[model samples]
Target: MLNLSESINKTLNNFAENTEMMWNFADDATDVLLGDLDTEIASTPYEIVYQQDRVKLKYYKSEAPVKMKTPLLVVYALINRETMLDLQPGRSVVKTFLDNGIDLYMIDWGYPTRKDRYMTIDDHVNGYMDDVVNYILKREKVPQVNLMGICMGGTFCVMYSALHADKVKNLVTTVAPTNFDTDQGLLHSWMKSVDVDRMMDTLGNMPGDLMNFGFLLLNPARLMIDKYQSFLENMNSRDFVENFVRMEKWIFDSPDVPGETFREFIKDFYQGNKLINSQMELGGKRVDLKNLTMPLLNIYGKFDHLVPPGACELLTSRVGSTDVQDVCIDTGHIGIYVSSKCQREFAPKICSWLGERDGNFSEPEVSSPVKKKTSKAKPAALQN
Candidate 1:
């Protein structure tokens, strides 16, 4: 009877301790939640050099000397805004590039309206992208510019390089899906069966909210549940809350993809797998992978579910480039750019790779006036 009483006393004490801890956590969380937080993203300063309809070219000037003779044009996917690259000062790919003396240009495929529903892959590739490249080439007075693309943007860069090989000095693709026939990812499986024509006919442009819902469905347990649960647990930390909110802004700030672009991307690339089979066409010309003769750097996340390694790894063999390198980083799709470890690997690799290939040329003078846009509150272990 004495031992039983002691056991009960111990149990009650433990429960009381846990309850006190919970109360402390709640108070701290409330304090942090009520505090002023700086959640603004894409805070890197840039100038808008060229604008065509919804697409704009952003030029990020480096205070350091330009190391590479060839300027880099970064093309991000249409689904997400390019603000993702400049997510935060510490984890920013843009800041890393600028710090490394890379003269950078990025394409901003702005929000698509109902009128943009008629825009197709051909229009984006041959029309807007080509025009952007030409403007860069002329503005910089360089014969060729380095091209890098992310996700769908990488696929676009591949097509652009193949179609206009002479204008591209080197090509870099990050987590870009080229061969989509494999069922390694749920996206590929769903896309294959998706009736894109019907979707486009009914919705005009592919809705951003719908796309976000689909991506959330991809890994609901982690992306939807686990992430928020983590937030609640760490809500007392101001830095944690700030970073969490920044990512939340980027993840949900998805823009609607153009209708015809979405339709063709689904039917041709995902369904028929025409790109890998050499059956893809744009602007009345075949996109011959053999024309990708320039130096190629293909970087993809090993654990990327949306664009699996199987989808990206096949490109090196198919491309005509003799000096090709494939780097498989141990990370997920978005993690490749934002993860802390990758901050060390990702931009440095590009700098060294480009520096080696960057031939001798005097620095070019900036002829165009710096056009500043108002600051809008927006917004990696290598295993090869």
Candidate 2:
């Protein structure tokens, strides 16, 4: 009887201790939440050197002497802003390239509105992208520039390079979905049946918020529930809070996609699987894979849920480039750019690869000052 009484007392003591700990945690969390925190992202400095319509071009000059005579143009998807590459200083892909003596230019597909609803895939790939390339070539006095694309942007780059092979010196694509026939990802399956025509007709431009909601539904356990639970648990840590908030800012800053472009992308790329088969067309010209004869480097995340390896691995086989290489990083979609492990692998590999073929193309003319429309703004996105 005495032992039973002691056991009951111990149980009550444990419960009281847990309650006290919870109160202490709550107090600490409140302090952290209320404290001033620096959560700014895309801190690496850059200049908006060019703008056309709603799209802008960002230029990041290398502090070191430019090693590659050919400058690189990075094309990010219209779904998300280009800020993901320069997310933070220490872990920035932009910083890595700059440190390696690479002169970088990235496309900022600014927020679209009702006016942009009629814009088609041809308008982006053969129009804005083509103009951007021409501007870069003229500004740098180079006949050809190195090309890199990410996600949907990568798909655009593939199309661009194919159509205008003469302007591209070397081509690099990361996590770019080309083959859409496989049922490897949830997006692949869901996009196949997506009634994009109806959605676009009703909404004009595909709403950024609607896209974010759909992405969240892709993996709600991790993206929605557990993510917030982790934030709650670690809210007292300033570092955790700052990083978490920064990511939140980036993820939610989605831009609306032009309706015609979205409709064509869904029908031609995802449902019809036309790109890999060489049946896709832009500006009335067929996007033949055989036309991608420049030096090609295709990189993709092995475990990417959105653009799986199955979608990426087929490009090297179909491209006409004799010099082709494929790299599969062991990570999910966004992790390939933001994770520490990828920091050492992703940008450096490109720098080295480009360095090898930098001299293989038409040499850039002597450096000269060129007039440009310069502006600056917060490097965040409207979508993806």
Candidate 3:
């Protein structure tokens, strides 16, 4: 309703204000992102209680008084670092367990070199895992410790639990693939069709970057393109930028998978589909699911692409235990551990499930590490 000069002045004022606002946002974003930031995770205090050739045992001493008798030992997949479990302060599963008074232990499978290419599943389950279990039992003076594994580590735990049933009091597997017959996941199909033997032979060890590339191909739109696009849109916020960068660090911090282990897993578990059928063997011993007599908790993300529900749901039926629980959370593979909503549900569910089975034994009689045979490839079936 104003004259030409007045209208022009108003328009110019509005344009100038918007430009200034945008410039301010750009400056803030630059400082927040390019400025010195600490993206390094797994910051919770812990002690390297034990170490072997290529792996180290991290025991996170609870800040509060220890309430649980059976200490929890977390075993993560070899493909990625276990830092996902403790990404940050509020979003840390390790912190939740520590706050809940659980004496938590974690196995850090450090970077695998060419020398480790010959380290087969037998070497992992029977050799290193065995030694770690003995060390924990000797220190805690408990007959058995609770074993929880994530993704491929869960598969390893299942094998270790079956082979050495006496050492595992309870078992928990998160997004672990046991039955590989379904077409729900891209990995299952690609693995069946891929030439893993030639790949292993040529590479010596499956490079972490190569494995990550394969995972990205599963859903490029969401993982590669959309995620970063969303980050850009939200980049103006300092908190958003910080969290996004933290996750980026965790995702890219993957380790090379050993060649022998990769070859055996591809042939026996994926191609042969022997885990659920009770035909899988480790260390020359049959990995019978019926040998898993301890209380079991199998968890899978409803939208997990790497290990879909079909791959994880059949464990309860196959295991030898009468006490078994299968939990399907509303999340994806990584979200099951990192997402904020899941932070409320995931660890709580685990603590509850474990608390029910973990007897109210106030003090377990401290005892020496049971002299166990360093059996090369033999199954240590539970005592009847």
Candidate 4:
């Protein structure tokens, strides 16, 4: 409808504006990508209450008045640092629990070295975990404490709770793979073909980067391709860039898993699929899911590829606890713990669950799991 000259001028002006907009985006992106931004994680203030070998117990002293009788011990997986729980100020799981008047304690399984290659599930569960629980109980002067675990730590908690139900007032596990018979996860499929014996013998410890790459392979398009693309697309935003970098740091900060421990977990849990059936063993003792008779809360991510719902949901049906509950969060593995959307639900749910269970304990038994006698404990060998 316009004259030829007018139409041409209009088209040129539109093109010039588009070009300028892209240039502005590029400049802002450069600033975001290169500019200084704080990426520090686990910045919540805590005192190291107990230390033995590479492991240290972090007791988060809260300013808020305490309401619960039992102090909580947070056990994280050996694969990564527990810092994920306390990544930043507002997003910190530790802060959330503290703000809610829950006394909290966490285990920092520090980095592992070559000498840790021979450590096994027995050592972790019976040696370090038991000792840690003993330390917390002794320090807090409580007979039993609430124990919460994530991923591998959850598996350990299950094992511990099954063996020592009297020590744990309530049990909580998030995104923990229990029944590993399904084709719901890439790790399940790939681990079937893996030569864990050769890998452990040759490498001593499984590299964190290698394990991380395997996780990335689970969804190449989303994790490998699209995530970076999204970052690039939103690189101009300082907050976005800072959050992205923080996650990246956490993801890559994995520690080499101890060789024997890796071998046992891969063979026993991943390959043999023993935990659900009450067939796994640790430290000359048997690990029976039926032995987990404490008040149980099994939490899992619905979209968790690493540990599908099939892997987690079976725990409630299998465990011996009468007061068992399964909380299926509507998010992925990491997002269930740290996503802004999940932040309001996740910690509050856990705190409420624990608060309800705090005053409602079964009749007191003469023997308790958390009351193990420890005159002086030695250092555990491996790091996280």
Candidate 5:
């Protein structure tokens, strides 16, 4: 009887061990599969135009009715690909604006090569961006274009608006960092300690991988470990899996920032806080934020780690636009665009806001609703 009992115990232990092994194997397989899916979803369509030196413009197009009110120009930060706006058909901010009868153009600061190490903030804000705006204005035969900027791109737009306010009919900035002095965020604080010159000297051109890694490090526990574990728990559902993969691809699709530009950004804006202080200079011209008198819409993510609400809110008070309005969404940085909840709420709000200002009377028809496809999903507040 004792011998029989020992054999049965051994068999039960083996079964438990096999179950644990299988679970681990399944987890690994799920990870590999999700990684592959992310690559496929992020490869959305885009067109490239006017490549010169290391700068290129990439954009997405949609059909528009003739006599569209104002041409919309979107400027995205150089730290990542501009495709984040048009992430997918149903989930795209670009598509939403186009569907609303707005003519759209986006700036794609193509990945900087090693030789582009000398490109400065002036080159982007005052030189290349100015040329692009003029080109669009001349081609479209419009008196002015509506300007939108995202993150660092917002900084560029603000500078451009100060210099060429007459060229823009209205100005919009989303998740833009204007006042680096606000203590509500940690990113600017960290930037204060970085020796940008030494770093630029070492790297030549600031590598995208390095910038991406730093962002991930800011929320290492959540981005690195928790996010994947949650994905593992929901791998069986394909739709959830696809959306997850697409966002992953967007997050990782970083671009190299020019060294001189990065250096100036870190020193002038982050360290010196010169832009808001009215001491900032670009291309031998002072960047006077008070000169921004065009109708301004400043949108920011309330929980954004990169550009905190406090950092972004200073513009409403500083800019000369008496019509300035601030919209603080209950979101984090990327959530301003991606979160499924945002698609339903934030996008509609933006569409309405823009439509009202442009004299567009037609209501936006809701595209096919994208179901909450992800399983084991975290709340939008937590995910962002």
Candidate 6:
């Protein structure tokens, strides 16, 4: 019996050693395969429609152009490029909206340069955003425009709508953070504790790479390790490999945020929790949530690590809009916009929601010539 036990132990040790060796070999092979896939994926053709500053606005054109009942403007976060909306032909939010007869205009907050170091939230929300909105109003000859804000862009859109209620008909916010007090979001907690002044002083412009690294750290086991393993197992499949590569390109293609904007964002929004509290101010004007009276649709993700349901739900209570609805989709932060599952459920839901509200949509009437006021009302700050 002793001899039999010894033999079994030896066999088990040999098996364990062999398994380790196979794992090492597989890891090496996966590295090489992924490297190749990355190169191929980065080369995929993406058609971006408009360019403002360093920002690129990519859209998937509809096969048949249908005149949308409402002209919609989409504002994406400045942290990353806006390609996530139009990731691919079939899996595109913009395409889905366009196909559903929504005329879309997305803001590309372009790459911030050294000169843009002092660019504040006001600049984005008031300056550039105002210009874009006015341009759309003029081009379409519309009185009021529908505004859609995603993530941080949603926060900006909310502010913009509040300050310029006359310019906006309806507002839609997807995965936008309004309450930073929620503990469910790891990113918000980190931002709350961060010394924005020191960080900005240390780095004139907040490095995009650093922000990307933080996002990766949020789900290291999944994003950094498990994803690679899955890629290797499915490397032989061309479609899978191609899709993987495209996602990787979109993931790594991050843009640097301006320093002043970063400083105010951390202090005012994340740390102070000002937006919901109505303590936030932009360009010397207080950002009162009560000022937002237009119809509002707040879309949130149930499992979003970045902007949890709690963070987004706060908007419904804070905003003065009587006609407000909250939609909670079962998806993660990025998955809400890009994943195949969300593409079917999330995108279509937005289209339907907007369509239902189309009755409220009205074009801005041409103003009759009048004596100009001594001073025009100051535009809201441009920061999204």
Question: Which candidate has the highest TM-score of all?
Answer: 1
lDDT of each: 0.86, 0.86, 0.85, 0.83, 0.78, 0.77
Model 3 worst lDDT window (10 residues): 365-374
Least accurate 10 contiguous residues by lDDT in model 5: 375-384
lDDT string for model 6 (1-384, tens) is: 459889999989989989987677677657656665433321223355556676554433334344556688899998887778876665677766666667677777877887789999998898778877877788679898899999999999998998888899889999999998888989887887788899999899998999999999998999899999998777656567767877888888888999999898899888899999998888789989998998898888889988898899989888888999888877889988877656666666666557667853222111111102201311111011
Which regions of candidate 1 deviate over 4 angstroms?
A: 1-14, 359-381
lDDT of 2 by residue, 281-340 (tens): 888899999999999999898889899999999999999999998888879899988876
- Give per-residue CA lDDT, model 3, range 1-384, as digits (tens): 999999999999999889988788888878877887766688888999999997999999876564777999999999889999989876788887776668999999999999999999889989998999999999999999999999999999999999999999999998999999999998999999989989999999999999999999999999999999999778778778878989999999989999999999999899999989999888778999999999999989999999999999999999999999788887899998887666666776677667667754322211111112111211111110
How much is 193 displaced in model 6, in angstroms? 2.3
lDDT by residue (tens digit), candidate 4, 32-145: 778889888888889998888888999998666555788889999998789999877667778777766677999888888999999888888888889999988888899999
lDDT for 270 (candidate 3): 92
Q: Per-residue alpha-carbon lDDT of model 5 for 123-151, expressed as tens digits?
A: 99888999888888887798898899999
Runs in model 2 with CA error above 4 Å? 1-15, 359-384
Q: Candidate 3: lDDT of 53?
A: 94
**lDDT at 187, model 1:** 97
Candidate 1 structure quality by residue, lDDT tens digits, 278-355: 779998999989889999999999899889998999999999999999999888999888876666666666766776
What is the model-wide C-alpha lDDT for candidate 6? 0.77
Between the candidate structures 3 and 6, which one is better when assessed by lDDT?
3
Clashing pairs in 5: none
TM-score of candidate 6 against the unseen true structure: 0.81
lDDT measured at residue 188 in model 2 versus the true structure, 0 to 100: 94
